[model samples]
Each structure stands twice: as C-alpha cells, then as structure tokens.
Target: MTKAAGPSRRSERSRVAILRAALELCREQGFGGVTIEKIAARAGVGKPTIYRWWSSKHAVILDAFMEHIATELSFPETGDHLEDLRGWLHSVARVLAESSMGPLIAGVVGAAQYDPALAAEFHQRVYLPTRQTTIARIRRIQDEGRLPDLSPDTLADLITGPIWFRLLVAGDPPGPDYVDTVLAAVASQRFPASAGGEALQ
Candidate 1:
C-alpha cells in the first residue's frame, strides 16, 4: 500500500478488530453487559479508536452479527419453494437456538423501542431480508401461475407469522410437523385468499 493507502488500510483493520471483539464480548456477556471499554481492551485498541468508528457498542455488535450470521440469515435454495421455506425457517430456529443470538435480537428490538436510531438500523439490516425472502418465494409461485395472485407483504407475513409467534410467546422449538404445516400453508392456501392461501396439490 502507498503511504496514502497505508492509513486507510490501518483504519480498516482497526475497525474490523473492534467489531470482532465487540461481537465476541456481546455474545459471551449478553446484550446488557458488554461495554466499549471492554471491547477496546479485548481488541487491543484504545477506547478512543472504538469511539471514533462506532457510535455505540450496539452498532459495533450489529455489524459483527451481520458478518457472522450472514449465511444463516439467508434463505436456503433447493429449487423447491416449500423446501426453501422449510430450510429458511429451520435456519432461523437454529440461530435462535444459539445461546447468544436469540437474546441479542430480542434485547436489541426491546431497546430499539427506546432508541429510534437502533430501531431503524435493526429493521433495515435484519428484519427486511427475512421478510423480503418470504415474499420472493410467494411471488415466484404467482409467476409460475401455480397460485392465485396476492400481495407480497401479505404472503410474507402469512408464512413467517407462525414461526415468530412460536419464538416470542410459546418459547417453543417447532418440530418437523409444524414446519410441514407451515410449508403446506404456503403450498396450499389454507386460509382465506387474502392470507395468500393456496394449496400446492
């Protein structure tokens, strides 16, 4: 790297180091416990360096989570829409099963209620992808003329609601039977058509 490039590269390295440390700390300590000073110490950088890059510990950890869970967050593809839904939902459940992620996401959402900035980033970065994926799958069905037309938003919600409900309220692990039902609902509209109800068979 040239002299000009040297500083930029160093900055990038420092930013990544801080993000990595912050993620590990937050995962190990829970959302309520991690701090900037601790992250700085863990990353071997000064507190000022961390403060210069990220507005808060939340931002740093958010970026780290985006990096670590990018694959898991993505809906899996198997050339079958129902299978895609099953794999995607199971991927979500598996992430929640992690000791760290469930609490981190729940805590972030709760905090975002008080911090508008955090709330905005969380929705933009994390919430939107899963929702859009659900919609895309349904839209593909519509394109294929296999299902009645429906709003993408409605379809996304219909497919994902059960999983979120089970996650937040029942605190339950959804079994294959439940996944089958969800997949079936997508393949076959079970409710009124407004709910994007369609039967695959």
Candidate 2:
C-alpha cells in the first residue's frame, strides 16, 4: 500500500493552496469579493483549516500579496548604491503599474480606513518592515559617502513618495522612465557635504 502524506506535509500543501486561492480570487473578483468561504472552497480545504492559520480574509490576502511580492520587491546589492536604488524603484513602479497587486493594495488601503485591526496589522506587518529596510539601505549608502547628507527618512520618502502618489492619488501609472526621472530630480538637487566632504552638485 502506498503511504499517505505526513500531517506536516499535508498542512504545508494546504497552506500554499489557500494562499494561491486567495491571490486568484483577488485577481478575479477584487478584495471586496473574496471571503473565507470562497477561499476555502477554491483551495479545497475546510473553513476550519484556513481559520486555523489566518484570522480573516484580510490576513489571508495580505499573506498572499506579501509572498507574491517578496522576491521581486527586494533591494538588489550590485555594489553601486545608486544603481541598486534605481533597480529597486523600477521594480516597485512595474509592480504597482502592471500587476494585480496594485488593485489589491488599493483595496486594502481603502478597507484599512474602517478596520483599525487591519490598519494596525498592516502597519506592523507590512509598512514598518519595508520602511525599515529602505531606511537602513539608504543609511548604508550615505555612510559610504555616495549619497548626500540628508535624513535617510527624507531620502526614502523622496524616492517613494511620487510613485505612491501616482498610484494612490493621481491615478497615473508610473511608466518605464519614471525611475530615471525621479533619480535625476534627486541627483540634481544641491545638498550638504557628504561623509567624504564633497557636496552634491
């Protein structure tokens, strides 16, 4: 007789299935239409199975979204901080402009307005970690004397603010050249001396 899968293996498979189902449902029906019942049905798992792992549909969807973007959205270390920043920002623009993730993110942001729990979870789980990573990377670059002497937080905002504005408020897609444009604008600004005692021109 063939041996059955172990409990841990089966549980992991179910978890992957649920996350996949959540993403598919979000793509097909948007976040508003995705429910625990629908996700469980799509994943071929019982409601209790899903509830055992995630608290709500929001938690499931957020996990799916984060898993999907985790690889592509990371900062690349190419030994050139400016180039790395460019690549990272370009990835962000592409993901926001071209993927289902954009709508999902917008939907989550909208829902978070009314759901304090979700907003707090999002801040704690998603926003804070990413922001901390970006700030740390920028601080490292500054320490290398490659970037201007400015608050890393301010620099991070200058880099990401416009892209988010276009996606969330302006309803405009950040196009292929957007990253370069933003970088040029940033590089053009005159700033105080760097750690190497050279001013940004």
Candidate 3:
C-alpha cells in the first residue's frame, strides 16, 4: 500500500507546485503573459506534464485561481448571519484591493469576453459554483429570518455586483466603507409582508 501511495503523493505534490507556479507567474507577468512553457519551467516540470493535467493555459490558471479562492474566501457560518455576511464581504473587498489575485481575476474576466471557450469554461467551472454557493448562503440567512424574503439569486447579485463593478469597470478597489454601504442597502431593502403576499414596495 505504501508503494502504491508513493506515485500518488508525488503526483499531488507536482500538481500543487504547478498551481502555485501558475499563480506566481500571473502575479508577476499578468495572465496574458502566462503560457504552458513558462508554467512548466517555473514548476520544474515538463510541458507534457502540464498538458497531461490541463488542456490549456486558461484551464491551468482557472484551476489555480479557483484553488486560491477556495482557500481564502469561504463564507463564515456564525450564528449572527448578518455579521458573517459582513465579514465575508469585507474579506472580499480586502482581497480585491490588496492581493495579486485581483488583477489575475480581472485578466481572466477580460480575456473571457473575447474567447468563447474560455468564457464557457469559466462560467461552468467558476461562476456557477460561486453563484450557487452565494445563493445557498443567502437562502440560509433568509430561513433564519435575518434577511428579507428576497429572491436569493437576486440577493446574490445585489451583494456581489457592485464589488465586481468597482473592480472591473470603475477601476477602483472596493473598501470596507463600500462593503458597509452594501450591507446597509441590503438591510434597508426589507420587503414587508402584505395581503397580496411579500411584494417589493
């Protein structure tokens, strides 16, 4: 069993090294400058080794980016859901404002605009999973009666859309104040129950 596990452990180590190298190169050279050759060289692996795991540069970088996000941006599940949401949003703002991951994400989003294959892969591998997770969290908060009975999907968009806009379009980093403002807006937009059922007033 130990003999069988040796190659698996080595494979896992190689995969981690490759992902880390890809992210580091992205920080140093920007996403457009990253290539399979560069990643292989930085990772101390062969081109065939990278190609064995990922089909393209975009795929490799996307996986790396996803891993980084998974490590850094988990929604906290404290009993005070509102505070948890606030903390998570603040964490996102900090990352967008202060980390190399910000520009890397912006580069991927910009590239996806013109590359259909990359866009599709991004939507499938990144956007959908993230969106689903956000919606689920919103739904849970609503169930706990801390949030309004708004559509979780719409709530998810409302919570995250401004941050993306600031990062991608406004050319500005979202700050803690911006996060607080968003939370205030969310808290203020309460849909009160009526005879006609809960409707936006």
**Estimated TM-score for each candidate:** 0.77, 0.88, 0.84
For candidate 3, the TM-score is 0.84
Candidate 1 per-residue lDDT over residues 136-182, each given as its tens digit: 77777667765445666766666677876776667774655676687
Best-performing candidate as measured by TM-score: 2
Model 3 lDDT, residue 7, Cα: 82
TM-score order, best first, reads 2, 3, 1
Off by over 4 Å in 1: 1-13, 145-148, 173-177, 190-201
| Greater-TM-score candidate between 2 and 3 | 2
Q: Write the per-residue lDDT of candidate 3 for residues 1-201, one digit (tens) a residue.
A: 445558878889899999999999989998788889999999999999899999998899999988888756787877777778788888888888866877888888999998888899999998887787777777778888877677776677778899999999997879989989987888678764531232221
Cα deviation of 49 in candidate 1 (Å)?
2.1
Clashing pairs in 2: none
Superposing every Cα of model 3 onto the true structure, what RMSD results?
A: 4.4
1-38: candidate 2 lDDT, tens digit per residue: 98999999999999999999999998889777889999
lDDT of all predictions: 0.73, 0.83, 0.83
Tell me the TM-score of model 1.
0.77
